[model samples]
Every structure is written in structure tokens, then in C-alpha cells.
Target: MINPFAPIGRGVLGVLAEIGRFTAFAARAAASCFAPPVFAGQLLRQCMAIGYYSLPVIGLTAVFIGAALALNIYVGGARFNAESFVPNIVVLGITRELGPVLAGLMLAGRVSAGIAAEIGTMRVTEQLDAMTTLSTDPFKFLIAPRVMAATITLPLLVVVADIIGVMGGYLVAVNSLDFNGATYLRNTFDFLENQDVILGLVKAAVFGFIIAAMGAYQGYNSSGGALGVGRATTNAVVGSIVLILALNYLITAFFVE
Candidate 1:
């Protein structure tokens, strides 16, 4: 007799096995991050690549998101004669949620895929093996630097995103919404607290770690050739986004209470 639940059980087992492997890889990567023989130059280069280079996209996205958020908040709040809450809500939304989440998602698509492709190509081409032969630990030289860079830079990016996001809301409110510039700024500042910003930055750090870790994990384990690299890249992006969203909710819940 054919069991209907067989396929479902196998799928569940497969997912659990994947989770276990990823958790093991993440542990090794975290340990390598703290181990000695730090590569300063590689770390700096990665910081530039992952953080500085990502600014334009993050800024552009944040600004537009903030503007749109303000518009929506205004429209929604107007029904309750609470349109004046737009500045407060916009600032709160940008600092506490949108800035970090949007930045993380953007980096998952951009930085995570780039890391996966680069490392996966190295893996398939035997470049990573050559490093092993040369007595240089690839984890220390490659993974650690990229991981450290992403972890350090993402919070900074979120800070910039928050600032730009607020400015975007301010511009829209003052110009299009007929709000007084001073009043909007005042409300935005008055309602926003340091704890909110801190929690968001903390989320950015975790998201950054997830982005780099997932990319490195997929690329490091990739096999075959071009097809493998392509698969790794896709997995890196998808895995990062899923982890970021899941962790975002968890972290928010932790901090909210």
C-alpha cells in the first residue's frame, strides 16, 4: 500500500537536515570570525564593497520608501482626523522597521548573490583548494573578512538609511502635504526614542551576519561547475531573505516585550 504521508515526511526530514547543516556551518563561521590571523586589507576591501558601495541603493530605496510611507500614513490617518501623526509615524516606521529591513533585503539580493557567485566560482575552479595547499586557511582569509565586514558595515548602513529615510519624509511632508517644516521635524524628533534606533541597528547587525554567512555557506558547499555556482547564488539570496525576515520578527518580539 502506498502511504500518502511518505512524501510529506521525507520533505520535512530534508528541511530539518538542511537546517542542521546550516547551523553547523554558521557555528564554524562564527568561530573563524573570532580566531586569530586577521586579514585587515581584505576586511577593509570587503567593507568598501559591501557597505560603501551599497549606499546609493540603500539611500535611494530608503528615501522612496519613506516618501511612500508618509503618503500612506497621511492618507490613512486623515480618516481619523489624525493626519498630524504622519511625521511621528513616518519617523517611527523608518527607524524601527523599514530602514534595517529594507537595507537587509537589498543587500541579500546584491551583496549576498555577489559573494555566493564569487566564492562558488572559486570553489568550482579549485582556487579554494589551492589556498588550502598554500597553507592559508580560506576561512580566515576569505570568509572571516567578508563576515566581519558585513557585520560591521550593515549597522552603519542602517544608520544612514534611517537619516535619509527621515529626510525623505520631511521633504514630502513639508512640500506636498502642506506641513510646516519646523513642526514636522519637531514631531519626528519628539516621538522617536534612542531605544528604537538601537534595536533597529541591532537587527541590522544580525541581518548582515545572516547575509554573509548564508552566502559563504552556499558557496563553500557548492559542487559541480557553472550550474552549481548558479544554484548556490540563488540559494544564498533566498536563504538570506528568509532568515532575515524570520529573525526580524523574533528580534522585534524580544525587544518589544
Candidate 2:
């Protein structure tokens, strides 16, 4: 007789095992981050790769989202004859939620996949093994710097995104929506509190850490050959995006409640 419960039990065990492995990997990576000989150069390079190179895509995404958000809010507000509130709402939405979340998601797609592919390729090519043979710790040299860079740089990226997004909204409101430029800017600036921006930045940092860690974890553990590397890359992006969205809600709830 086939035991139906056996399949369910095995599936649960597999999930638990994966969680355990990921936790262990994260712990080791965190430890390596602090106990390092401090690879400053590698860290800087990663900062450039993860933060600087990502600005164009992030900016473009923010502008379009902000513009669309403004348009939507204006249309919705018009139904209630509250269209004047568009600027206030737009700024609030961007700083409190959309800015960090969108930036994080974009980076997850770009940075996570790149990290996973690079590290996965090294793993399959035995370059990581070669590093070990040369007395270089892979976690410290490769993983730690990337993780640190992401954590540090993402907030800055979010700040830029926030600025660009607000400007996008302003342009649309003033030019297309028949909004007074001065009033729009004033309402945007006046309505936002410091805590809103701070919370967004905090979320960015956490998202950044998750992005780098997931990429490194998936790549470091991948086997097989080219196929395995591709799988790791996909997993890295998917995992980072899922974690980012889940954490965003939790963080928002914490701040709101």
C-alpha cells in the first residue's frame, strides 16, 4: 500500500532542510562580514557594480512609476472632487512605500541575478576551489564584500529614487494635470515627515542584504554545470523578490501600527 502521508512528510522535511541550510549559510556569511581581513577594494568595486551601475535603471523606473501614480491618484481623486490632494498623496506614497519597494525589486532582478551568475560560474569552473587552495576564504573575499556593499549602497539608491520619483510626479502634475507648480511642491514637502523617509531607507537596507545573501547562497551551493548556474541565477532573483515583498508588508505594518 502506498502511504499518502509519506509524500507530505517528505515534502515538509525537504522544506525544513532547505531552511536549515539557508540559515546556516546566512550565519556563515554574516560572520565572515565582521571577521574579515576587510577587503576594502572588493567592497568598493561591488558598490560601483551594485549601486552606481544600477542608477540609470532605477531612475527610469522611479520616474515612470511616479508619473503613473500621480495620474492614477488624480483620476481617482477627481471622482470625489479631491484632486487637489494629488501632490500630498503622491509624495506620501513614494516616500513611505513605493520608493524603497520598487527600488528593491528592480535591484533584485538586476543585482541578484548578476551576483548569482558570477559566483555560480566561479563555483562550477572550480575557481572557488582554487581560491581555497590559495588560502583565500571565499566567504570573506567574495560573499562578505558583496553583501556589505549592497547593504550600504541600497539606501543611497533609494534616496535618489525618491528624489527622481517626486520630480516625475511634479512634472506630470504641473504640466499635464493643470496643477500649480508652487502649490504642488509646497504640499509635497510640507506633508512628508522625516520618519517616512527613514522607514523607507531602513527597508532598503534590509532588502539589499536579502538580495546579496540570497544570490551568494544560491550560487555558492549550486552544482552540475551551466544548467545549475542558470538555475541558481533564477532562484536568486525569485527569492530576493519574494523576500523583499514579504518584508515590505511586515515593515509597513510595524511602522503603521
Candidate 3:
């Protein structure tokens, strides 16, 4: 028989250590972000890589989610003659919840894996060592730009996702579900508040931070050459998704009331 308390204590200590490392890395990234001879070119490339390239996947996810959410709500709401709530449900679900969450997860997979692989490759090739030898701050030059680009671009992506998602729901409701387009539009506009949109943007920003930071942190701290880099990439993606879900709940509780 094993000691339950021993396992619990180890788990707690491991969590504390991870928290400590994460906090230190965040502080370093924040410092680098503010004090910069900014890498505008690199940042722009990252924006394109992270935002523009991600649109199709994000858009498709949002559209299907919006459609299915409409169907689900319509079916359930009709039980109480609440079919009119479809518009409200679509707008609220997309703008206030699914839009940010899905976008973050998608980007986490794309952006995080890219960051890890790129940085990991550099690490394997000793390019990072060269930068250190030249007195270049890898944290500032390598990590900061990615973090800032992700942090800025995610909100933009979320905005696009929100619009596309709502449009998707509208299409399905009007064409497939036999609802009037004008009434659907009016209900969507009337039911969703400014706070809903603003809250989503906020969540997007937080998710972005999580994605970039986790990727950078894992890649930067990676070990054991090729195998290690691969492991780091996998860990970064998984970690970002888990953290995004956890943060979503916290943010929802704060905003939903």
C-alpha cells in the first residue's frame, strides 16, 4: 500500500514549482516587451503566421459551432416554445464563449507548435548559443516578439471569428430553420450587449498570452536535443489547451454575473 498523503504532497510541490517557473518567465517576457528596440518586421511576420494563416481553420470551426449551437438551442428551447431564443443563444454563445475559446484552442495548436518547433530547431542547431555568445538577449529578441504578436493578433482573430460565427448561425437559421433573416438580425443585435463583445476580447487577450508564453517557455527550457524538442512541442500544445479551458471558466464566472 502507498501513502496517499505522500502523492498529494508531491503533486502540490510540483504544481508550486511550475507556478514559480511560469511567473518568472512571465516577468521576463513583460520586461522585454516594454523595453525594446522593437522587432517590427519579425512581429509582423508572426502576426501573419498566427492571425492571417489561422483564419480558415478558426472560421470553419466557428461556423460549424455556431450552426450546431443554433440547432441544439432551437431543439431544446422549442420544448418551452422558446424558439425565438435562438438568436440570443447564437450571439451569446459565439460572442461571449465559443468564439474566444475555439479560436484560442486552434491558435494554441498552430501557433504553439510552430513556436516550439522553430525555437527547438534553433536550440538544436546551436543558434541560440550563438545569440548568447553575441550578447543578444534571446528572451527579448526571440520570445518577446512572438508573445506580443500573439497577444495583439488573437483579439483581431477573435473579432473575425465572432462575425463569421454569427453569420453562420444566421445562414442556418434563415435558410435551413425557416426563420426570417430580418427578425434574426434584429434579435441578435438587441439581445447581445457591448459587455458581451468586450468580455470576449478580454478572454482572447488572455488566451493569447497563454499560448505564446507556454510555447516559448517549453521550447526555451527544452532538453535532450531532437526527442526533447518534440516532447516540448507536444507539451506546449497540450498545456495551452488545458490552461485555456481553466482560464475560460474563471473568466466566465467573473463576467457572466
Against the true structure, whose lDDT is highest? Answer: 1
Error of 1 at 248 (Å): 0.6
Give the whole-model CA lDDT for all candidates, comma-separated: 0.95, 0.94, 0.91
Give the distance in Å from residue 224's predicted Cα in candidate 1 to where it truly belongs: 1.4
- Model 1 Cα RMSD, Å? 0.7
Model 3 C-alpha lDDT per residue in residues 104-200, reported as the tens digit of each score: 9999999998898888888888889999999888887889889998999999999999999998889889988999999999999999999999999
lDDT of 1 by residue, 1-257 (tens): 99999999999999999999999988888899899999999999999999999999999999999999999999999999999999999989998899999999999999999999999999999999999999999999999999899999999999999999999998899899999999999999899999999999999999999999999999999999999999999999999999999999999999999
- Report the lDDT tens digits of candidate 2 across residue range 94-176: 98888999999999999999999999999999999999999999999999999999999999999999999999999999999
Give one clash count per candidate, in the order shown: 0, 0, 0
Q: Candidate 2 has what TM-score?
A: 0.97
Candidate 1, which segments miss by more than 4 Å at Cα? none
Kindly provide the TM-score of model 1 when superposed on the true structure, using C-alpha atoms: 0.99
Candidates in order, TM-scores: namely 0.99, 0.97, 0.96
By TM-score, the best candidate is 1
How far residue 249's Cα lies from its native spot in candidate 2, in Å, is 1.1
